[model samples]
Target chain A: MNDMVKLEKVVKVYGHGATEVQALRGVDLALEAGEFTVVMGPSGSGKTTLLNIIGSLDRPTRGRVLIDGEDTTRLSASSLSRLRLTRIGFVFQAYNLIPVLTAYENAEYVLMLQGRRPDERREKIMGLLRTVGLEGMENRFPRELSGGQQQRVAIARAIASEPELVLADEPTANLDSGTAASLLDLMAQLNEEKGATFLFSTHDPQVMRRARRTIVLHDGEIAADRHGPAGDE
Target chain B: MIVRLAWRSLWRYRRRTSITVSAIAVGTALAVFFVTMADGMYKKLIDEAVRMGAGYVTVEHPDYSRDLSIGLVVTGISSVIDEARRIPGVTGIKVLIQGQAVISTAGGSAGVGIFGIDPETERTVSPLADRIVDGRYLEGADERGVIVGASLAERLKLRPGKKLVLTTNDANGELVNEMLRVTGIFRMGMEEADGFLVQVPLDTARRIFGIGPDAATRVGLVLASPRDQSRVLEDLRRRLAGTEAAVLPWQAVMPDLAGFMAVDKGFNYVFQMIIMVIIGFTILNTILMSVLERTREFATLMAIGTSPLRLRLQVAVESLFLGATGTVLGLLLGGALSWYFQVHGIDFSGIYSDDTTIVGYAIDPLIKNHVTAGAFLLVGAFVLALTLVIGLYPSWRAARISLPDVLRSR
Candidate 1:
């Protein structure tokens, strides 16, 4: 059987012959179980594009992508969407919490999508709110909360379905440094204790410093791969 | 959860939702009012027609139906009457003879349609005997009196005590004239049926026309229920099939009346459709604006496991809820309007609606209103269906939202 995640010589290209932009060129990578990894790059470095392919929101152009030994490239779009719902989660830079929903409801939305019962949902949501240190603010809306609280709510929402993988695309880009640091610490704690594999994209050195491993992408290819507890490169 | 969210969402945008719901409600109320008004006017016309001696169904000789004359009486009249009475909804049966005759006055003379009826039997068939104004109706076997329309009396300059001569061809095709006294001045407001319309005793009419006592030009029937008129007509046909007589309803006997009523009904229907379309577009506008404002919210749900079909169903349910509420409120509003008109009447005496009776029916601007229950249900259903039809497209668009694009935008 294959490992937890595998990308063997994957390529993603845009445009035709003359105007081709190779977003990913012959990339090969593997993530073992319970890994906290960050893909870092400069502008136009294809980090977001790479994250999208692994998150099942986009397709690889010329190679196979697999998760837990199953080929993701062979799955239909609908099935891929189902896989994302059941086995993966996502957080975005804009704190993409639905503005219409309260924080408790926003967190419960994922559990409802997963078809969890009400009592089970109550326990999970309350536990998650306390875990993210936003216990009393569960009833607050996204607009009513501070930036750090909203990110915490987003984190609660991301892990609500208990997925095997979480792909966060520049999650702390809009937050202040203090809020961003706290958010990263919460995510790292979850990763270390719960064995949930996280793959995030960012260019921030603070985020990179906290990551267990950071893969740097330059011009659509891996420039430097670093692995340690904290900045052992 | 979806329903709760949808309902709560409406509350979040209170002004927008209220405006939308008010638009729907006003649309529904307007539709209900017009639909019931048309139906009430039509019912009044039919009720007056039935009350003024013409029953729901009329059986006549196939030959004289084209051009009626007392000289043309069908044989086997007794058997036809017996068979017609056996029909399930038949309340009463009456025989009548009609013909064009010249009534001579001291000054001049003019042609008029003379109606011959059996007075005793006619009392069971029509309530017109109760609406006598000036003098008594044709009462006894010795009575030779005839009732005349008020307009006809005015034109001829004749009074209840005046003497007039009515002349027509006999049933054997010979000319025979009768001298009679103007017994009563009966008035029904109908221009054609009453202005030049006259009614006489059947026995006197038969003797003058040289026709037999047992024959009649037509047999008018009253069905117990107006809605069961066709059923009674069918029964009359089956019973009279062996004889040479043709079974006829009022529609068959009076083609001109049927045609006029059909045109009026068509006009009413067109008006109804126009009103419904207006209501439909109002709902469409409101729902379209609602979906447009919630584009991002809808996209977030789609990004979760809520399928497009589920989202569409959610929208449809919301529409149904709104439509149902509107329909109920509208029905009540319409009922109130109909009742107001039914009691007080619409005073159109100001403009063109003043004193206008279309085609011998009393359709003055202040017409009597009579709303039936069938019309109430149909109008309610119409408004509800219109809301659904108009709401479908906008809801479908709401369901087709793409989350990736929505998330990518600023």
Candidate 2:
């Protein structure tokens, strides 16, 4: 498979002099296209910082970050937004759906930003909702739904645009074990079926177990690189 | 969808918007009433002037209205009448013959100007028919009848069918006496007019003055419109060229009345400005506050790619929405009031029943204010435009809100 994302000696620094702290330091990594990869770390481990750099949500303070063979660290804000819209999809731990919009509308929001036609949105969004088991609950608001149901809606929203890369920041941090497993299973299924790359930042054992590839980081640097049950990596 | 969004936002602030709009409506309504009433009252003054001494236009024995030179008098009424009748827009003409006279009666008599007028034509031109509270107008030119001014008739204690001895100085320097039966009492409601005016037949005036049937002191020409008074005077100057008749406007005949209109117009404009200044600030204050409150929403919209200028335009739209609705409501109410007043004029009967003179025009003290649609629309538009323009500052502040502050706070 093609390499979907590559990072080389990336560093993110905050403040200066006595107040300085480094968030990411000289970390290099790559993941194959259409792979389900999970980065596991304890608190303050820079897993989210790495995920943010790879997802095109944030840029590195030093070194180069490449996605689909183009250097994203150098892109301007507008260009970065365009890249995020066309290529990268983000699923936050909090769901982060607009309070006023319903489940179906929340899923429809990303596609709208991409300027997709309503007809195109209707077909794709309906299919994704069905796939994520939110078929009949499309009109319900996030506040009105169960935590598990809302998470499914968030996952459905993240993949609704058929983006090439999906970055989930602490996807199962707020879900029950059973719901977390089911959500991870759904993401794994989508990653295989659609050739869509999935990368997640999580401390959950179940998520780490389900991931086909795992990267372990400690104190802002890579601690280990490990593979799934059969030792593919 | 943009319009739908704007509409929804407005509905969300219905109470506040309505209050602001109502304020504008009331302001516009008041402005409409004031402007139209001032305009109407001023027009009425001109109409009364037309009804009084000065005809819409005057043709003289050339030097009459000018230096009042008696030598320039027109010699023949027949030719002057024929020439004046052919003048375009000259509605009517009347010959006025006046001379000083004294009378004796039980109530006491005073000197007055005795005018000679054709009874038939006089009925058409003067309001003499309306003023006959106790008697009838002179029957005809040869009826040997006379209409005395109310105050003059009162002074002489003369009643209809009573005979009064009239005396006038003739052209030959002889005093002439004739007996006239009181026919009607003419009332203009003016102190000077009521005290001084008396009407007699043309033949009687000629007989008393010892002049032939032809000569008269002045010729009066009534025109189609009071606005045409000056234009008619100009035409008379050209038409009666080389004649001794002094072509003059009523402004020349009665300079005080013309000065009254000028002063009234100036005061009206000053009052209009003050009203606008006081009310315009109310609209501006409401609109400015509305913009300041919607800062975050504006920032989100701009972050989503709406230009700053378009955001400002949205504020303007909101102002127009408020202004237009209020204006429409005020117009409906104000128009209803104006119509009611027009139908049943307000009466100053109680206050001025004893008689009062206002700026030299004898009128009721209670003046009803009338509103016109044009005035309503103009004031509404003026206020709306003011509110929208003032909204720009707050809109700009909203558009400039930074995204980091909003999302970070989020």
By TM-score, the best candidate is: 1
Q: Give lDDT tens digits, candidate 1, residues B381-406.
A: 87788778777898899866656556
State the DockQ of every prediction: 0.37, 0.09
The value of fnat for model 2 is 0.00
lDDT of 2 by residue, A141-165 (tens): 7778887788788788788887889
CAPRI grade, predicted model 1: acceptable
- The complex in candidate 2 yields a DockQ of 0.09
TM-score of 2: 0.62
lDDT of 2 by residue, B312-350 (tens): 677667766766777777777666766676666667677
Window of ten residues with lowest summed lDDT in model 2 chain B: B401-410
Each prediction's TM-score versus the true structure: 0.86, 0.62
- Fnat of every candidate, listed in order: 0.20, 0.00
Question: lDDT per residue, candidate 1, A122-171, as tens digits?
Answer: 99999989877788888898889987688778878888887788888888
